[model samples]
Target chain A: METVLRDAAAASRGAPLRALTVRVGPLSGVVVDSLRFAFESLAPGGPAEGARLVVEETKPAFRCPDCGTLYETPVGDYHCPACDSVRGELVAGNEMELLSIEV
Target chain B: MCESCGCGETNPHLHEHGHGHDHAHGHDHGHDHGHGHVIPVRSSALALNQRLADQNRGWFRAKGWTVYNLLSSPGSGKTALLERTLAAVPGSAALVGDLQTERDADRLRASGAPAVQITTGETCHLDAHMVAHALDKLPADGIRRLFIENVGNLVCPASFDLGEKVRVVLLSVTEGEDKPLKYPVIFREADLVLVTKTDLAAAVGFDRDAALANIRQVAPRAAILDVSAKTGAGLDAWYRWIEAPAS
Candidate 1:
């Protein structure tokens, strides 16, 4: 995290890096809040200091055909409450990426 | 400078003066001074791999193939069942994912079904990107059923979507009947719950009713099938269930 900030700052040449928003999915095994906390703590003294860190949470969407119900499951199960379809379609989740960086 | 201004000097008088300044400055200051070098960055940690996964799903869709993501714990008889299914049903091929080695895939090939082994290296689960890459490298000729036998770990595999038409969750009778109740979320997303290794049920003190009841308690509507890939006891039911029309 410090290295990331340092590299971002080093690349900026003290010009000022703006807001950095990150997309974190539940499946990525990264805790969004913890990452945000780390970023806040590490960003204060570096080029990321006061650099707006926006954390976007991504969740996996699942739909059960048997029950005709669509809902979001936690990082664990994908079962539908109305119908216990173990093989429902996973519409989303498993996302982690750098959306954009403002400098 | 410290001695001249009495700042952190060795004298008690200097300490007193420093304490006084600190106390005096404790009052609220209305002016707000923002810090410099704020990092303005928007990015996802999984952005790179997720892009690849999307492309993979698109590729599978373009080919008109129905992918089944098979998930279960180690020793849940996932590979064994696949072997039996291939033997029973003629038109199925598989891409088996594992941490290392093609042992499972090699065994599967004995059923006269072509299978590609996807070694995940150190990863616990088979993610979308790996499936996509494996699909590109596999022979996509005259195949109707495409099975993605995920690395055997219930926790991690539940989090990924490998673009499967069905995400089948396998449970062995010997593993305890409360498995589904304990892991409801995985069972919740399962299109079908297969209770495997039932041939050894009696020997292993496996309670069929208790397990079924537990699964029912969590996922009452899950299409449950009991089978022993060894004795071929209930595989026909499993095959029929898999071949059932997708509405």
Candidate 2:
């Protein structure tokens, strides 16, 4: 979470850290509540203290390499419905990122 | 102070933006100075770590070393596979990650490879920073291949990139065939899925076809190989894959 603080400060040109917007994907292995808890606990008396945090959750997006069909990976079914191509690239989601900071 | 929300006197921003109704014409300075605007970053939370990982990748590539990041659950036979690979290949080095034990590192060393143990303590995954620090501890200069045995985990480690040329996820036959289905994120990004401990498949009633189908579904692009450290089954093919320039 300090990474968010430090990066927000950097992005804001050394301005006092302010509210942050983060994107946490479902498959990012991060729990939003846990991240919020961490921020609340770790931000006191720091640059990000009292900073408003907005988390944007994203769904996983997969693109089939064979036919370029893009779809969400359905539960237990990974093969592309159109081409039967199992070689689908995960193009989105799986993201834990800092989207913006209000400084 | 030509005008614009008394901020024109102190705020450098408003002076440059006199484009009418820009909160102009002398207003109160009682409001928060740093309010109103949001800057978009749109960067990975691991951006710094990623930059470091990229450096490690380029460094390893420049040194002509093909690095592999090994991921799996605990008891997935990662150390066992590496022990065999290092013993057979001769010029391989390893960086082992565990919560606390140096046992994996010691075992690899005994197998005639320079190995460094990174005890991550509480960290579930090994990061590029740790890998960079461990690189100095091992004599990997002349080694052709470097294996990073990631801390035995299926989920957390998947998000951290270790700057490896190939990512190999091991699934021991003893570990249920539904592992890939259960942990699709890790398997989805794997380059090679080594189905280990094949010698015990029959005894364990491991469903080979189901496992293969699941692996293909999750990691169709990954080269799948069956290997057993105890019985040396399919090891020759494993070694060839490692040695193959096409990999």
Candidate 3:
């Protein structure tokens, strides 16, 4: 978030940040509530003061190596639902990115 | 707070293309206000940590050291297992992590292995930077086996990769048999699962079969080993497993 804010400040010639959008995935293992709390507590004193943080969580997704089927699971289970195989490779849900910033 | 470039300012100015933003991409220019534009900034939070971890992995490979990350909940006998392993295996070194103690490292050193304590202060887990810094304080040369005892916590330690050759997660019999099911994320990432404190399995009424079944469901790819560090039970097999060349 700080990185995004700095970039936004530079791009907009030091304009106050309005809002920041971030993406959090299930496999990232970061608590979204804690992230929002930390942002709220720390953003009050910086260039991001009074800025709103919008968190968008991405669901865990997996792909079957043998059958080529993409699917989503409840965080921990990696089994392929179509083939009943336990060898589904994770293809998504590990991302933690600052998507965009409004300044 | 950028560590890569020592800019005196707290906010490091990023390069125009640092985040790989492509202006050619589709943009909704409905708003005429130029003061606040939604800049597409796609940047990973863990990019720096992952890069450092890759560097640590390269360093370990160049040094010919087999590094194992040992993780488990508190009171899972991780230190005791390390003590037994160091006593049995020669040319072993350890980097122990804890919130506020040198006690585990002190005990491991007494077991005849050079050990260093990484006091994390209030950090819940050990990152790649901490392990890299601790490597400098210890006699890491010619060490065949490097054991990093992570801070005893199942949830946080599973997120940070310390660039270990293998991750070994421990589950004591004294804990519930459904530990693997309850903490599936850590088990899913474990290369090997050690069922420790086997001597007290019967006394504590620990369901061995149920525990193994749970582990199999969560971590089908992980090799499971049952060992008791107190009585030296199954230590030989564990030692051989560690010494065997990675497949």
Candidate 4:
């Protein structure tokens, strides 16, 4: 979030930011609430102060290495639902991205 | 002054804003501000941490040091296990992290192993930069194994990669059998899971089978070991596992 804010501030030539959008995936291990709380606590009185934080969550998905099946269910268990193979690896939903910023 | 935002004010007034909405794509703004522009930025928040972690990994590899990251919740006996390991293993060093105090590092150093302490202040986890800084305080040569005892946090520590060769997550029997299920991300990323405090398993009514089942379900790839750091039970196997060459 800081990185995006800095980039936004740089692009806008130090203009006060209005809003920032971020994408948080399930496998990112970051709580949305905690991110919001940090932003609220830190963003005040800065270029990002009064800037709204928009969070978009992405659900985790796993792909079976053997059957090459992509499925999203029973997030804790990465086994493929079709073939029941335990060789499934995470293919998506590990992202923590700063998608955009409005300044 | 805020370096990133440059608010210029030392004590900037905080604003109480409403919870923002979740949008799949670009926001549809009904009110058009003449100066408002949407700038796209796709970047990971952990990018800086990861870059430092890669540097740490390269440095460790060049020095031929076998580094292990020990992570667990508070009171999982990480310090005790590290003490025993340092005492038993020759040419081993450690870097212990904590929110405050040098107690763990002091105890580990008492075992005759060169240990450094990293006080994270208010941070819940140790990043690669912190480890890199800690490495500067210790003699890097002649150390066969370097163990990093992370801050006693199961959640935040799981996300920060310290560039260790192996990540060992500890779960004491008293912490309950459902710990793996509750904190599955940590278990899934663990290279090895040590079920510690086995000496009090029966006394604490710990369900060994249930705990094993839960761990297997959540961390199918992680090598699980049951050990009692106090009684010296299973420490030999743990040592052997650590000493084994990376495959």
> What value does the lDDT take at residue A9 in candidate 1?
50
Between candidates 1 and 3, name the one with more favorable DockQ. Answer: 3
Error of 3 at B38 (Å): 1.2
Binned by DockQ into CAPRI classes (incorrect, acceptable, medium, high), candidate 4 is acceptable
Top candidate, metric TM-score: 3
Residue pairs with colliding backbones in model 4 are none
lDDT of 1 at B95: 93
Candidate 1 residue B41 Cα shift, in angstroms, is 7.2
DockQ of each: 0.16, 0.45, 0.51, 0.45
Off by over 4 Å in 4: A1-4, B1-36, B245-247
TM-score preference between candidates 3 and 4, better one: 3
Please compute the TM-score of chain B alone for each predicted structure, in the order given. 0.78, 0.84, 0.87, 0.85
Q: Candidate 2, clashing residue pairs?
A: B4-B24, B4-B25
TM-score per candidate, in order?
0.65, 0.83, 0.87, 0.86
Off by over 4 Å in 1: A1-103, B1-32, B35-54, B217-221, B245-247
Best by DockQ: 3
What is the two-chain DockQ of model 4?
Answer: 0.45
Model 2, B63: alpha-carbon shift in Å? 1.1
Q: Which ten residues in a row have the lowest lDDT in candidate 2 chain B?
A: B16-25
Give the per-residue Cα lDDT of candidate 4 at B67. 93
